[model samples]
Target: MVDIAKVTTELLLEETKTSGHSPLKFICNDGYLYYCKYLVDFDPNEINCLAYEIVSHYLLKVLNIPTPDIALVKISEGTLDKSKIIKNRRLCVNHICFGSKGIDPSEELTEFETCSSKRDYNRILNQEDVVKIALFDLWINNVDRGRFINPGFNYNLLTVRSGNKRKILAFDHAFVFGGVEQIGVFNSKMPFINQDKFHDSDFYKSFISYMDEEEIIKIVENFIPLLKISHKEVIDAAIYQLPDIWKLTPNLANRIQEYLFCEERIEKVKTVILNSKSIY
Candidate 1:
């Protein structure tokens, strides 16, 4: 079983002013701040986002992309109902919710105006991670981060500054597998395996110059092996470990794992990345 750290939401801070679903900011009992996504009464389907958040965090960690540490946040009874803000937000009282540990000295990547420039790229401590994250988004069919064509970039990326350099921390996977609504329709047969949702994004363009074709190929090559090792043991652990409150049913979970580790889909990740704009 996955040993996910657990914390209790002791106090409600305020509604964070950010894109996607606005998670409630809270200072958990651990004395650290976390942006917690809770169940909402308005739409039960939204809970699917929490499942996506937790699973994606695990998968991203496996890919070695930097992300905020996640926790299984415990919201004591009446925590949401007692809040004066609950009326407007319409949050439910699910005891267990997904919490992403807050990062100090951090801001969204869009806040850094120079993020598109070479000068900013030089200060990024882990510049190569940018390439890794882009590929991960494609593999998961995450259209929320930097969709250039229609709704525009949602700016899900975060930048944590340290001295003159900075680190990129990828967050917000609620929209993966198409989106919250589409989560139900997601199956192993979906065409996500060879999709290209990331390359056209400005997020990818910001670091495209820094990427070497050979390096991108090598990264995906390394990732393919991980999918094959103890298939049920590694991938199933992510599904089974999730709290039952999220409503990630056995049938849905089975489809998700199948979609994620499908033999044909697993092999297509490398091909999709190679077809993106040639770095040469």
Candidate 2:
């Protein structure tokens, strides 16, 4: 139902420049603001960027994570053929920022740095925080990806308002699926389990800790219904655009279905979340 015909490269550039990120703005015809990051080289005929953004937003919402808003858009002066344009079909946009506050982490961690670290299985994530983040990732099917490298912040630590303590907002989800280099793996290359590192650094240990197992379960159970709803919406949208999308990446059609229906090891996750929550 995204109106791809309405989008133009010039309009995309204009909206992007205004948003303050890289020179890309995501404006939806339905009236929403989306921050974008171009992964592949920019091209006029390419519409997959809009598709990924739409699906990611939809999935995150389903998982009950505090993600940004999203919608489809049309550009006034696009580079694609005008006659092939479909009204209300084509490009979509994500339009949500948790708040106006910006993040300032004390340390910086790059994608490359994480990958080069020594393998340490004992240094696992705190169960509770992992659960929260995992829930977020699972809903969005951000498989094989990690929270540490999310571009929304300079680092992975969640930020909050100093006065009111409002939930921190993060955006720029255009890279949910594996890119040209790593087709299927989602998480960053850093090892997930590292007990030695966790014990050595209080800050690192605390970051992984959670509230309680019961509390973690509550959060997960609460998100199940939302996930179901989100899955349906995405499936419907993907089905409608299956023909066009298949032409771009045939694997996506099958992957989407597998991700939606896959059986997650929920009980094990609950144990981890509960144990981590007990750390503090």
User: What is the Cα-based lDDT of residue 153 in candidate 1?
Assistant: 56
The best candidate in terms of lDDT: 1
Weakest lDDT window of 10 consecutive positions for candidate 1: 81-90
Local lDDT at 261 for model 2: 48
lDDT of 2 by residue, 93-197 (tens): 322211111233312233322212222212322233334555454334342234332332222234333432234333444444442233433332322332221
lDDT of 1 at 271: 67
- Cα displacement (Å) at residue 202, model 1: 1.4
lDDT of each: 0.71, 0.37
Cα lDDT of model 1 by residue, 243-278, tens digit: 776676446667667777677766676566666647
Off by over 4 Å in 1: 77-88, 92-94, 111-115, 149-152, 193-196, 228-231
> What TM value does model 1 have?
0.85
lDDT of 2: 0.37
Top-TM-score candidate index:
1
